[model samples]
Target: MKSNKKFYMVREDMLPNSIVKTAMVKEMLAGGEADSINEAVDRLQMARSTYYKYKDGVFPFFNAENMNIINISLLLRNVSGVLSSVLNCIANLQGNVLTINQNLPLHGVAYVTLSMSMEDILVPVDDILDKLQDIDGVINVELIGKS
Candidate 1:
């Protein structure tokens, strides 16, 4: 199956009343301003059905920009200096590391997942992957999210 969905960024002032109200309701819920959906809807004077219909579909523009966050999973040989080498390579490329989670080495290999921002990276995603793959102890480097 193919996805035909498309997204656009528009000014808040240009949005319809329902969409704006839905956003307010979402904020109320997230900020604990309202105890429940019913309370939020009542406080915002918006129908509960309307809030549900658009809550999942609408997000602040800043969040859309955060789509640049990339998740990379690596399989590295369980040996000294292997992980350090990977970090150095990423640092050289100017990618900003956000979060890293790694599993204990087992059976001569360790699984590592890293979330980083590519906004300031000097090289393209493919180039970074190529360099990572070329590392001596890096058995695999897989891009796990949108690049």
Candidate 2:
């Protein structure tokens, strides 16, 4: 049977608060931050009905565990050792770097794209992005694609 369901990648800020809250409630439950559905909804000030309505449809992209390969784009200051630091961060998280494409520095900034295997990643993909952003000289980090 063919499924007609469609998926889209949307920025969180552009989505309705209900959908976002629904995802949050689900995470709270999964992470044991909320013991029950009622508690989860109440903690977020969301109605039980709203939670049920969107629960099956809303999911965080980074939570897709079956995805094995992820491509990320980074903007970094054109300085020595910045790119190396980013690679080290990924390695430390158990992600295997598969490919890297870096552009020449333009106006003191460089754009780099990396494809990595997530098969052995020890942390959530979102956490990897957060760590990359925290690295010195990294101007921006964005998840470009995943497979």
Candidate 3:
């Protein structure tokens, strides 16, 4: 089982500006946005103090270190809007979709691969998959990779 405990890790060079930007980018990225804190900070070249000054002001949603992501695969019926429902389900479950790939449906079957991570999902992942499979158009769900 994955730990739900919260912990903070800061490097010697991590300043307040760096921290704030890092936190913001992290939050946005977790919501299916692009570019992590490292990318934004590296792009803006902001100091650590600036980040720290507005850290509490920006977002209060920061939970814990969330780099460990899981990759999943699924088989679904070749029908309209099924993928959207799956994406919505992931969001409702508090899981962030990092990457997605879907193969062309032939003979009414589609293969989907998703990479995601959940910073605060308390529900067991097995239950999550079962719920996804229970979707009207979903045929099967599987966890293919995790790290």
Candidate 4:
């Protein structure tokens, strides 16, 4: 059987304190702010069990070091130059497009899926999405996956 896991993008302030603290602890350990898990948890006054429980589950969306590739789905008005404009926007943001798939327009709307490398992107992913959404004839932009 396949695992039925799902992911969501949530505001930091809305997360429970334990989950937030676990992320902080991981950051501390990775950044050398704390020498070990024990030290990191102690510094944060968080329980070791709590850290272990959430360590693998919580991650910051804008962590450039860990997030290298991302896939996005877009809805576009079936007008000339719309797709070109979208690609230009991604290139302007320094995102390397790895793959692109566009379905035939149906009812004046086109669906496009793009897989791109975020390694060279200077701006945050959210900013990239915002810029894409701002383009004329672009109906919507959604970040569907990341790795």
Candidate 5:
């Protein structure tokens, strides 16, 4: 328990060079360009000391925490700007809309299907879904898949 008393943290600005090197190392590893850390450090013009400073904690953009991608379905009140409201909700959630499909409005309702990235969302799915369900002009909202 005593060992847990000490916590380690790295400030973002303190290791500027090392942070950049860490990204370079990860890119090299992904492209099958470097098999060894020494090679990666040399190829990216990074020092072994910099690599050691941030190696374990740094990762490239491609390795972001996209644990899962999910699909969503929204019921919009078939009216002008109604779809826009749904889109605004997605933006508020920081969701990246990959695809969207809207069918012809039938019975005053339009069904929509959206594929979005939830990796950087600002809120949990249930909360977003609930808020969407409560939005004006949004008749219904449901996550079709893991979204």
Candidate 6:
């Protein structure tokens, strides 16, 4: 039988102890708390086989190290407050706007490109895009580049 499974983003406190321990063990290994997998599992009182089983299946919601720079292009309606709304959305997500380039409005639409630092963004890029799409006067949004 073939099965399709759905995953969820749940709070840490809601997870089972074993799953939490699996994440802990993975972190310990990544942070060099232990020289080897065996040592890390031993220190955590978890089995090596169990750790390996969940190693690839579990990870933290956000890894700050991966937060870098991203450039996005947007086509917005030529209207007052449209640009402000976009910037405000980024700010609300804690994204730092590095540079903004906007083309003059033509045919009731304006093209905008923004470069931002993602070091402090609370959620993933996809979530940010979804929020931007929810705002009025935003015609379209695309992730042009990321680093």
User: Best candidate, lDDT-wise?
Assistant: 2
Model 3 weakest 10-residue run by lDDT: 57-66
The number of the candidate with the highest TM-score is: 1
TM-score of each model, in listed order: 0.59, 0.55, 0.56, 0.55, 0.54, 0.55
lDDT of each: 0.87, 0.92, 0.75, 0.90, 0.78, 0.87
RMSD of 3: 9.7
After superposing candidate 1 on the true structure, give the runs of residues whose Cα lies further than 4 Å from its correct spot: 1-26, 29-67
Estimate, for each residue in 8-105, the C-alpha lDDT of model 5 and write its tens digit.
45664665776877877877877888998899998878888878887766754344343457788988888898878878888988888878999999
lDDT of 5 at 79: 84
Winner on lDDT (1 vs 5): 1
Give per-residue CA lDDT, model 4, range 1-147, as digits (tens). 324788899998999999999989878877889999999999889899999999888887756555489999999999999999999999988888988999999999999999899877778889999999999999999999998
List candidate 4 stretches off by more than 4 Å. 1-67
Number of clashing pairs per prediction, in order: 0, 0, 8, 0, 1, 0
Candidate 3 C-alpha lDDT tens digits along 1-147: 665757555553554555656565656566756465555545567654565566554443434243657788999899899999999998999888989999999899999999888655768888889889989899889999777
Residue 62 error, candidate 5, Å = 9.0
lDDT of 1 by residue, 30-67 (tens): 78899999998898788999988998888876563535
Q: Report residue 100 deviation for candidate 5 (angstroms).
A: 0.5
Instruction: Report the C-alpha lDDT of model 6 over 1-147, residue by residue, as the tens digit.
Output: 223766579898998877888989878878889888888889889887888888777878865444588999999999999999999999989889989999999999999999898877768899999999889999999999998
Using lDDT as the yardstick, the better of models 1 and 3 is: 1
- Model 5: lDDT of residue 95: 82
